[model samples]
Target: MLTINCPWCGPRDETEFGFGGEAHRTRPADPSALSDAEWAEFLFMRTNPKGLHRERWVHSHGCRRWFNVERHTVTNEITRVYQMGSASEAAETAPAAEQAPATAAIEKQGSRS
Candidate 1:
């Protein structure tokens, strides 16, 4: 099982959390202006990239707070964890050397598997 580091509650078993889907999606400025296809795309479309992916997650069994996670899809390695609304585009594109300490810990865990 994976150990997820909750920004509010520290590291916890993955079972304590709930997946909240892809993050950083902006709501349309005027929903009424959207055609049916556009509205459906907004609601259902998500990127299924093979490498790094940003996602939302909630600590359901602990603090019940929401956070964002940057994870590697194929390896299941969580590279970063940040509170909701605090992530910046620059941080998202930062180099590995500048990655958070939590990322190192998660990488270590991934290596064990």
Candidate 2:
């Protein structure tokens, strides 16, 4: 019953979207050069962190566009939503204090609902 705000289509029901797994995963430049174990790791290995997690989500029932969502794993609070290939990726490595603005925005949005 979460409300996900699509970067292009605004807020919509979570049911309208499809989870696209962990975000920011870089595929190998030459897949054929990888060993079996290396390829397997690339396909199956993903971080399962307990706190903030970056993920990809597609608005399947709406615009059908994909975007990134920074969510809290335990609380399911979505802290930020941005279009693919944006500069927001830099925020991933930013200090926690630098991320306060995004978190505040989410908190404000939640208060409205």
Candidate 3:
């Protein structure tokens, strides 16, 4: 049983979260520009780093926000977690899973009251 620590919602069962592959990786803006191999690489290849790897995780049950997480691949231990930001953030830097869009939406709703 894998458990993930959601920065906003605390630690929860792994079933509540979705593994989003490597963090800081984005789909090509123009798929047409990519060659067959490049497209395949994007879709299939991934760097399963042994240590201090960044990954994306979605909190399906709690905040419903897609965020990033820092984990150890070999040991299956999570070191850090934060929220995924805008598209640009995904490109430049993969922020942790504390500030996802869903949480932002929830925060907005709370502010309205």
Candidate 4:
């Protein structure tokens, strides 16, 4: 079974999470200014890269919070995991799973208030 590290919930079985599609897909600021083709492209176009892919995921059975995941498609190896608004570049280089001060521990500490 593949282990996915959730930003808030820590490492867990893949079954506990929900796979959301590609990440960083920003919505157009001026929707009314876009042509039909441009709108359609934004709505439907997605890169089906065979190598490393960045995506969104939700810890459905755990924290129930959404986060980002960088995974290799062919090997199904998760390279990194981070929260939605975290530094994507940093997460891509160093996965939260391997970081010393994990966000899950921080979150746990915060909840004691």
Residue-wise lDDT of candidate 4 within 1-113, one digit each (tens)?
77887776578999999999998788999989999999999999999899988888898998797877878999999877756654454455345445644554222211222
For model 3, residues 11-107, the per-residue Cα lDDT tens digits are: 7899998877887767899999999999999989988766888778898988787767777878888766655665565444334433443233221
- Model 3 lowest lDDT segment of ten: 104-113
- The RMSD of every model to the true structure, in order and in angstroms, is 7.7, 8.5, 8.8, 8.3
After superposing candidate 1 on the true structure, give the runs of residues whose Cα lies further than 4 Å from its correct spot.
86-113
Write model 2 residue lDDT over 1-113, tens digit each, in one string.
Answer: 88987765667899999999998888999989999999999999999899998899999998787778889999999888855663455344335424434433332112222
* Candidate 1 C-alpha lDDT tens digits along 1-113: 77998765578999999999998888999999999999999999989899999888999998787777889999999888765653363344335424544443322112221
Instruction: Name the lDDT value of residue 84 in candidate 4.
Output: 69
lDDT of each: 0.74, 0.74, 0.68, 0.74
**Positional deviation of residue 67's Cα in model 1 after best superposition, in angstroms:** 0.3
The reply for model 2, stretches above 4 Å from the true place, is 86-113
Query: In candidate 2, which residue pairs get closer than 3 Å at backbone N, Cα or C atoms, i.e. clash?
Result: none
By TM-score rank, best first, the candidates go: 4, 1, 2, 3
For each predicted model, how many residue pairs clash, with residues at least 3 apart or on different chains? Answer: 0, 0, 7, 0
Q: What TM-score against the true fold does each predicted structure earn?
A: 0.74, 0.74, 0.67, 0.75
